[model samples]
Target: MLRISQYSSVSSQQSEQQYVPLKHVSVETFIKFFAADVTIKQVFRNDETKPIEAVYCFPIEEQAAIYSFIARIDDRELIAQLKEKNETQREYSDALEQGHGAYLLEQDEKSQDNFIINVGALPAGKECHISISYVSELDLVENGSRIRFVVPTTIAPRYNPNTGDVSSPAGTTSKYVQTAPYTIEFRCQLEPLKWLEKHPPRKGRVRQIFLLTDGEISNVNEVLDLCRSMATSTRIFSFGLGHSPSRSLVKGLARATNGCFVFIPPNTSVDIHVGEQLQKALQSYISGIQVDWNLGTTVMSTPTRIPPVYANDRLIVYALANDP
Candidate 1:
């Protein structure tokens, strides 16, 4: 945390403007095969001579399960617990009105991914740190060994045509970008496939091609053609980034190779988004899975519906046994 202390006393005639209390924010993420964990730390300081409050708005994954929130005011630490939305709001309001250092965390009803954090009543030259933690499942690529992970840094604006309720959740929308100063796009060349062809899949091995894109591509057919040729030898998993990436190209590539595609929306926290997409993709897998059981000589097994299962995935089986 950084503090600003250099300031000259203002003249009585000069009017003083409000100072922005937010200093900076830092985020860290850790990801594994099946899950992603994130920690966010925000620093707020009051540089002015009077007490003030600071409010920070941010976004997280819609599916994220936040388990911990801690507020540090110098040496004193306050851990926030889960409560009803209304209860949490009231408590935070009361604390702030009473001039106590209060920290509040709440999710937006309109969008689960959006969040508002309030730190109330910091005395002059004082600072506070807010820490948040959450966990979400990681998404599995079409291939068993490889997975996809993302951490969103920004939440792009969304358009709302209806005017009934104009208010939106925090971090939900912002000024839209009509034309970026410049645009850069990347595509797969498939030149690597030739190298892989020389060394074909042997034994029980699997080949995978993972694609991640943030924008639309003009040459969807060409990419599909290459995927079609390599379908027998490879599986391609695709991810569409941002609000409206090219669905045709993403799905077509995956479909051509008998793989899967997942669309990532804007305003999604990157790591959480990656984890959620991977988890969703893994859930779609229903092929090449089996369940086995061993029973006594006098026992018999009943039939049951077995959903598609895949390798390295979890399956729960329920069966009825009777005497033979």
Candidate 2:
């Protein structure tokens, strides 16, 4: 499985003694060619009879270009204009102390991928929604074009190798995760590609199964076993959505079936373009692709074995040149 570091973490504590403030987070991403527009809506409610304040620390992609930020309390919405970091912090603090509801969004100074959000002075039974929007570009990769989007639902414990950095809260302890009164439900609409299901009626050829899911499956091992049994007939391609997916399960299935797995984040739009791209890729799919180098030419190439390559896929070759 590929490893990506510095992603947003959502707290998930199974213990009952922890206090969780934030309720639900809804993220919408619209992809346009190489660029994508992302919007994140965070809802927090004061379940208690008394007024309360909520603060949440999260992460955003380091390269994302954020443009809009707004806070909504009941029907009254407050648009946040860009200000100096210190000025913004002071204003938000003053608003909260005066019993007025306020919201503050800032980037973490120490870590490029970390962010902090402060939602304050929520009245009893009142709900606050904070929406943030940004735009970012997608990169072209091997095996045609691949796009990856990630949303963190759980904050994992961090291990800082550097201990001298006391200016930032890099080593501070965090709260545990528990079920909140307000539940967050995320829905993803996938345009089914029927072409993936068709298998060429020939020897040593296999059909591809694209499995798309936003949650974990209970029978992961069983599903893997089934895929192994059908290894001769079909190839399994697994896609996990959101942040808290079962990484082992998704990667295991692909590894077992000699296929590929990908995790899609909340900032990517799997719209009509996705389908068109898939169609283009499938049309260029070659069952068994091999590379041949000149024999006895004192040449060497890494990866020694080449996987299946599509027509649009870029073939990268790395070699070491020696003096004759």
Error of 1 at 158 (Å): 2.4
Off by over 4 Å in 1: 1-22, 142-145, 161-240, 243-324
Task: Give each model a TM-score.
Answer: 0.50, 0.46
Candidate 2, TM-score vs. the true structure?
0.46
Candidate 2 clashes between residue pairs 3 or more apart in a chain or in different chains: 9-155, 10-154, 10-155, 11-155, 13-177, 149-265, 150-265
Q: Which candidate is the best by lDDT?
A: 1
Task: Kindly list the per-residue Cα lDDT of model 2 for residues 191-251, writing each as its tens digit.
Answer: 2322322433267676776777654433344545555665566666677666555554565
Residue 235 displacement (Å), model 2? 36
Against the hidden true structure, what lDDT does model 1 obtain?
0.58
What is the C-alpha local distance difference test score of candidate 2?
0.55
Q: What Cα-based lDDT does every candidate model obtain?
A: 0.58, 0.55
Cα deviation at 108, candidate 2, in Å, is 1.5
